[model samples]
Target: MSDPITPLAKANIPNPKDGEIVAVAEDIWWIKMPLPFRLNHVNLYVLLADDGLTVIDTGIYSDHIAQCWDALLAAPPFTDHPIRRIVVTHYHPDHIGYAHSLSERTGAEVLMSQIEHEKSMALTTLDDVAFADMMIKRYRMFGFDQDILNALAERGNHYSDKMTKTPDAGYIQAGDRLTSLSGDWHIRCDRGHSEHHIGLYDPARRIYLSGDFLLPRITPNIATPLAAAVDDMLGHYFAYLAEMLTWGDDWLVLPGHDWAFHAVSTRAAGLIRHHQQRLAQLLDHADHAPLTVKSAMDALFPMELNEHERYFASGEAHAHLYHLVKQNAMICAPDQHGVDYYELR
Candidate 1:
């Protein structure tokens, strides 16, 4: 079940530098903003509206990025047209980080799904110490060592640092049609990567602004945030992938990261296979021996991980284990140490 890994190649869209805006499609501008992470950048889009421009996602809030926005707003095409509304795809810090700032600066309305808005509001007002304590408990349940718990407790408001305040937002839902500057855009609420993540599709143009639900080269990280405590994150992810597979193959998927791609069906299938293989390995390991989430993660993700990445790795390991338990492929019990152990059913 351990399939050989093949690198995914993106479509022929050039990588844009920080503060650079590239015209990826007609009347659509791709703006890249820097993130202080390995992924490094998020793609924000600008769609030409009738009298002004509508922004897709706002980059993380920072003075440096603010200067970039100032420059962009003062530039030729942007100067001629003001930003009227800002629509965010999800509640991720990078996507909605600067939404409030931009809305306040330009008096632009913020639009997002109701669940995402509620989750974002929850995250923005989270108590750091209490959240860290909760994370420690979750990690302990997943069999994380005391060292990891200490590191997590010392993490010190890391999540809040990346985000600004969430603004008053209007709600969007699945099957809703939003009339934008381009045309009527259909909203699709996809879960898994984030709760109720919204992706906009333009039937006339065959274009989909897919956010984190579908990326060009990499599968989005599925973590169990306190705001979203679903045990079946991968299940939700696969459901979304299967749904995307039914979409027409000619769609130009404008992802939150990486280049815009034409083969979403192919990408979705590849991601599905990847997860299926992971689940197979997980099942095989559990069949051989009862294991904790930490042991399972060690077997599944062999690469070395930093303290921050450990959080996602543990959550993803729990996700797979939870999926197996839900499917009755595995059974779980608490060990003497009060940690969960899973074995094949």
Candidate 2:
């Protein structure tokens, strides 16, 4: 089938520099690597500790990233000390892609939040096959054509090969203090973006490794189709934002994407404001007559969207619309074709 969206190569974003490590702090390095989506790159962190090296996140399971890892493992700094543990911030393929491979190569234990580990395991199970099919139907209900639906399902199944083989060695919970990698890093867990999104905080350095909780440029998506109970992604997101504001301005934020920066408080405020603005825009565009979710999505992201862009755009639009409906600001109705329609309440 012809791809609905242009391939990453045609998107014109620069391929990530090969195997270059940017130092975010003393003994803490950021390894920016390529992702096969509209988002061009993801930042994986590495820390040199007294015990052994700790890799915070692994890049996508692509040949380029594999080669980059091979080079890094064979290089001076990384070669000197073996990796002690492979710690994943979340279950997202971009963050945990090469984790299994790295563990196999170095005999490193893979540590992740219990929720993340369970979700990852479920996605690759036979029981998940029915769920995957149901997801395809749900996307179709949102007005996506068969071609796009197929692509989405294919991408979903692709995780079986990309993720690590080892089960989580240990589960890290919220408010837990980790003393392995650094002196003491606090674990903060939030929902909405991913099932068990984990962030690390170093009190001494005043640094926070925000997996996808607090990105600098773009807002982390807060939509979950696979949530067990009520899927209140926007609610989870705003609550997380409130939690982030409790931090001091002096805290340095090392996000999953974008460059590391200071001003965590300000960034958290800006993200909250951005969501408010978006919700207002959506409400204003939604009139008395019911509007399909796709119409609302186009109204927000009017630029010509390729397949890859549409993937995220559709999910994001659904997230905002779902939030509005829950807040009683909007209503969801279905057309005869079974497509969902959103309207102002």
Candidate 3:
């Protein structure tokens, strides 16, 4: 089947260059920071109000980005108003990495969902070797070879090494409302990409602060959750995308990565169809033979991948296979040789 996913279009505004802040709205500013990956930037926002500025998702901690932040903070709006709250949408390194440092420097309250805050704390508490061992165990179950597993383990805590420790934070839950001069943002929570990811919506402004939950271009990574690797994570992702279809097309999405974009409902529909096609692709392949996560990953991503990409690809493949299992459309057909497969009947 033809994949419904296409290159999602961005809003007709200039994307901010690295370290340069652009005005997203009358009182909101956009700061794009460079990342050391293929998708090489993250979008952070500052919401201005009479009381102070509210930062939404601090960029990952890097000397260059930190220096940029220090210089930006020392200037006009921030210097005068000061930051009152640092709202983190999730616990991803790129999202919450600089939260602790920014809060320390600006005396801003770092606010995150209780589940996300706990996950952040766990990341800081777990040492590199321990986290790497966890990865090895998880990937081993996904049918990765020992040699690749060892290589991946050496990359140890790549997520944690990028940032400072998380500070104590206040919690925000689903249905919570944060009212300010910026607008009345109604907090909505969704899971799949992460255990509990938060998005803020302001109907009046027609804006959605979609923190990796609804990226315009690509579907967010729906990997196995750390707590339960076998859970049907992709199912949760599907449900969230279905919910987005009801949100109407008025939103100007401020995503965690990529430039701002319009048409929330369109993007959501495309993403949902994208996942459905992927699941069908796997099921069709399984009709020929029993499928393992490795086989599915290869079929889904028909390209040569480096070590990190391979690991992520495996996780995404596993999520889909397990989702099929959860829906009773497939059954696990494990081999005693320390690898697992699934058969779609």
* Index of the highest-TM-score prediction: 3
* Cα misplacement distance, residue 219 of candidate 1 (Å): 1.1
Give the poorly placed runs of model 2, Cα more than 4 Å off.
1-18, 126-132, 150-158, 161-169, 180-182, 227-230
Cα deviation of 102, candidate 1, in Å: 1.1
Candidate 1 — what's its lDDT?
A: 0.81
Candidate 2 residues 152-243, lDDT tens each? 66565555556545355578789987664455788888887887888888889788889988776677776645535537687788888887
The residue-by-residue lDDT of candidate 1 on 128-154, one tens digit each, is 787687778778888988988898778
Best by lDDT: 3
RMSD of each: 2.3, 5.6, 2.2
Per-residue lDDT of 65-132 in model 3, one digit per residue for the tens? 78988878877667667899999988888888888899999899988899888888876787878888
Q: Looking at candidate 2, what is the lDDT of residue 73?
A: 81
For candidate 1, list the clashing residue pairs, or say none.
none
**Residue-level lDDT for 312 in candidate 2:** 65
Ranking, TM-score, top scorer first: 3, 1, 2
lDDT agreement with native, every candidate: 0.81, 0.73, 0.82
Q: Give the TM-score of candidate 2.
A: 0.86
Model 3: worst 10 consecutive residues (lDDT sum): 1-10
Off by over 4 Å in 1: 1-9, 12-15
